[model samples]
Target: MKKEILKIALLFLSITSSSTFAQETLDAFLKDQPIIDMHFHITKGYGDNEIYRHLNVDIDSAKLYWAIEDYKKNNVVLALGGGPLKYAKMYAGAERLFWSGLIFPCTKTVEQDKPCEKEFYSESELREIYQRGNFKSLGESMFNYYGIPPADKRLEPYWKIAMEYDIPIGIHADSGPPVERVNKEERPNYNPTYANPELLKPILKKYPKLKLYLMHYGGEYSDQSLNLMKEYPQIYCEISAVSMFLPKEVWEPNVKKLFSEGLGDRLMFASDYFGTVRKNIEIIYNLDWLSEEQKRDVFYNNAARFLELSDSEIREHRKKLN
Candidate 1:
């Protein structure tokens, strides 16, 4: 929690050095809506060292703590959780510390000595975990990976469980070239090309009812993402980390193109805000190509529909119809 707080403080410090933003803009924009951040990460002992090494950014728990406090102060809903499923317990603990909404079926691998690992949990054990915490959705599951194909028979058990619980499953779909040329800087492993729509076609056809999120706008293979959304109303694309990292000149046109192509309603906002930049909210708000209403949908309403928040909650945060 402290880390999030410090990051916000840092953001403010950074901004002040440049120029003071109009206080009214900050207050009105935030007060007018419930900014539910659909993507965040949490874990313990999993060092932030890698971020500094690759991205040259230093992050810590104190920064994240500040971020959360600032979000709450501004009436934002922080959808927080973590994985790597090996350390699910640690992630769960961190979620509670921040009073965050958890994401289930995280990819954290559990060691036998760890509190969370036990080969597999019984139905009761699974139910107990669900009941114990406040999880906003069901996953960060990598359905498409080598050895573990998107349509792999092994995932049926996990799918069945998610269906029984009626939670949204956030799946990883790699929409890029082969991994060999990929680098540590790009986080290559996460972008498995095999997870393309051609691969997931069978899986989606079979599990037609699964509420799934295609992370990263399926990367460079965005058309495949569009097709999936067209085929399945249950499928949504999360535009979080990708938007932040991409060159704005490129993103603005692509975002406009996505809407022009009729994929607007299915696009959801997820900042992937972890121990990283907290000013993304402001950056996104100021994106020039997308009109204010489009920004509101991306940042607010789309997520509200998926999360199924109450009408009253929606009314409280609805962006005014200009």
Candidate 2:
């Protein structure tokens, strides 16, 4: 009986010690690491609160402020903001925020005949916007929600412009959030058929030099995503809101598969919204399966490479974070 008690005690102590060590390692890494949120969104403007509320996430001013504070606390060196022209003005001159020009208007259902009252930039307008040289990236385009395929004619000009100017494009290429949760009306136009990663093959072939990353990695299309990245070295994927939205069983295996397939360098970190930024970072940081180098790549290095930031620029950004 004494021997049994001793064995149990030893086992308990061993487990406790292991857990403590893991926590300490994670804390140390997070404290020293610089993160780039490639998929963040500015949600303080028109109808943004309503959209969050519709998804059952109640976001008041207090929550928003806390989220912003959390970004600084987590050493988020840079955040790529997607949504509204107002977001650009909101974070104008803010060293930490890089605004991407959003071209789509927010609406409840894609089937809505008329566009939402919110203005969407036209091809010409986007050209003028790009000429200003303020937008670093071209998306979080929300094309899937509007039934716009990657090969759609409307996007051809934008693709040309992005390739011509060497702008990185971040596109939403998967179905997220159950339609019932956020859409009141039937959304015939919001089907996942267009969201398949394979649809991007044609565009990639047409513009071989265009830099682009698929957001959410096409929720359930992991195979297609992996194939695309394998075929096209320029293609990358960001694991954003999917980290928080998908079940652990589903999310973990998908991420593990990506790592197993040797796509770690192409996998960038993102936190689609302010509310989930820190949470997503924590999830990725605590992933025991990932090596320290892989974690760093996902959190910062991959983004720096994708955005083509120079060594001096990276050092400067790190200085600002410190």
Candidate 3:
């Protein structure tokens, strides 16, 4: 398949604009480009705050006073952020970010029950937020870390709301942090099988129209993610940290495998970056295997199509960029 899309250089935006605060200069090809990041996080507590020690920008904690501006610098027209409603409202009041529901349920375990756990919206609470038009999607759900599956009965209410409102659900169906690197005190339960994409089969059958975005490209179990997508048209995957964290040799093959399966259009881009948004975007933008157009879809079109962004909304995003 000869790759068909925009020219490489044409896809960049060479900018010295004030929007970027004079620190990051975007390539000209990406000038005023539109990208929809399907995975991002905002938490009341520290979450993957130190995943990439190589990057100069360590969030230190969940301090996000710099997050909104970071999004603007990298041309993230829209982002599906996973976190509590309280923080979502604070950040998204004027930004294009949308809350994708809670990342984890209130803790049944002692550690999670403290100052932050209760902040996760309950079913009734999410419904109220939805009613007020504050919430949009659901999950980025880290069920695996909790040793639970997507089909667990405890998650029924979330599925119900997703069906009722037609919002997409994002699941962390990827492997957890490397064993040696797993936080010392917070060694998560970290069940690999719990991240299995097949667990979503029941959910699909129950809510046929519901959209599911599997974050991390299924991590080590990408084959499972690929299989599920084959079986269920509504299933999509986000190539988040896979490109950023894995050895390119390790992760690139998986990406090639996806295109080989003809799942390119269903594939979406995500940084899940709490900082240095351009570092995340640029990696995908520069994929050796991707043509300009395929990169375009991953960055913007696929997500826009998946989210069903209205024409007006899409136009407005580009309007701001130019």
In order, the Cα lDDT scores of the candidates are 0.57, 0.71, 0.71
**Of the pair 1 and 3, which is ahead by lDDT?**
3
| Candidate 3 per-residue lDDT over residues 196-309, each given as its tens digit | 777878888898888888888836879989998898877888877877888888877888899998997898888885674677777776676788888888889988888888
TM-score per prediction, in order, is: 0.69, 0.80, 0.80
lDDT of 2 by residue, 34-128 (tens): 88888866545333454334433433343345545667877877877655565544453444445455545444343321224353456676788
- Any runs in candidate 3 off by more than 4 Å, and if so which? 1-26, 45-65, 106-123, 178-181, 184-188
TM-score ranking, best first: 3, 2, 1
- Stretches off by above 4 angstroms in model 1 are 1-28, 45-64, 73-75, 84-128, 131-134, 143-147, 175-191, 312-322
lDDT, candidate 1, 1-322, per-residue tens: 9999999999999988655555456557666656666555544333444433343233435444455565566555536344433344444454422223223333324321223234234566556666675544555554433225655555665566556766676665544335665444323244466557657677666666777777767356577777778888777777666666766665566566678878787777665655433466766677666777877777778877876778876664443222
Worst 10 residues of 2 by lDDT: 108-117
- The CA-based lDDT of model 3 is what? 0.71
lDDT of 3 at 292: 84
Q: Model 1 Cα displacement at 259 (Å)?
A: 0.7
